[model samples]
Target: MIHQPPVHFLGKTLTGQPVQKQVRKLKDLDNIFLDQAAFSAADMNRVVYEVFSYLPVDEGTEGGLFFGMTHLYPGTVGQEFYMTKGHFHTIENRAEYYWCVEGEGMLLMMDKHRNTWAEQMQPGSLHYIDGYTAHRVANTGGGILSFGACWPSDAGHDYATIVKNGFSRRLLSVEGKPALV
Candidate 1:
């Protein structure tokens, strides 16, 4: 249950992460690529994305809240847009909330049956991803597409499924705008 905190705490900027700073490269997105050849040919040394995770301070509880920010660099491979290596949760029933803080992007989601959904996101936009769906966010606009997300600490990422079977729809840049192809 949600309860009020007993003591005061200091707040910090989202970029201030004392826990983890993860960098994702083109090679890291191997399984989620629509154009495998393009991905393989793209510079493996290039840093494609970044993630900053902030864990709860001394949360001695199961399924506690965890927050993080993902930064997808703006670019493309062939026609497919640059996207995060999306994933489903190990605990399939767990959900997450994402709030866009910078740039523009799209949250692409799919279910086990290949049904797809896409949401246009800009600064201040908020979205929820159901635990039953596999989701990926792409940088469809210029600059860094950054978003903050919170989920259950126990809701581990299951990227294997997404890597094995990519999303049914692809977000492409059509006429300088995002188009689901």
Candidate 2:
């Protein structure tokens, strides 16, 4: 098989070529937020976040790597902070890495046993997500929260599991500060 040519990127700014973009709108996360009323009353067309990925090889290709950037806008659905739709990898043994590149946030993680925890994310912070963990990112700051991620190309997302069970904890803004509830 022919291999992809070398690619370059601006690490700090997350700018690169041959990237695929996907935008996630408020309506796309129907049951993600804690406040149903707030979500219902909010603008469904509002963009919550966007993902830019540099997939050198087709997704789900074994032995290949996937790189991407997640840009979560600053906002809230009621008291809850804006967050990604958390997910587990279809290939449960697949691990991933996340690096905070442009903003402040929280890397929330939950294990298969439902135990949950979080790590503060800031520019230059790096995190390792274990294979058995399901993870989500929450923008807890006053500005857009952007981060870079790397994972095995074969580690397909298992969003259905998260949508079905949901995370054990929720990150909310209390008195203008981020709190895990």
Residue by residue across 49-69, what tens digits does model 2's lDDT show? 999888988888999999888
lDDT tens digits, residues 1-181, model 1?
A: 9976432223323543355778998877776767778888899878888887777654334659887888889999877889998889888888999988888899998987889989989988999998788889999887989888888888888888887777888887788788887
Alpha-carbon TM-score of each model against the true structure: 0.86, 0.94
Q: Say what the RMSD of model 2 is.
A: 2.4
lDDT (Cα, 0-100) at 70 in candidate 1: 83
Instruction: Please report, in order, the local distance difference test score of every candidate based on alpha carbons.
Output: 0.81, 0.91
lDDT of 1: 0.81
Say which candidate scores most in lDDT.
Answer: 2
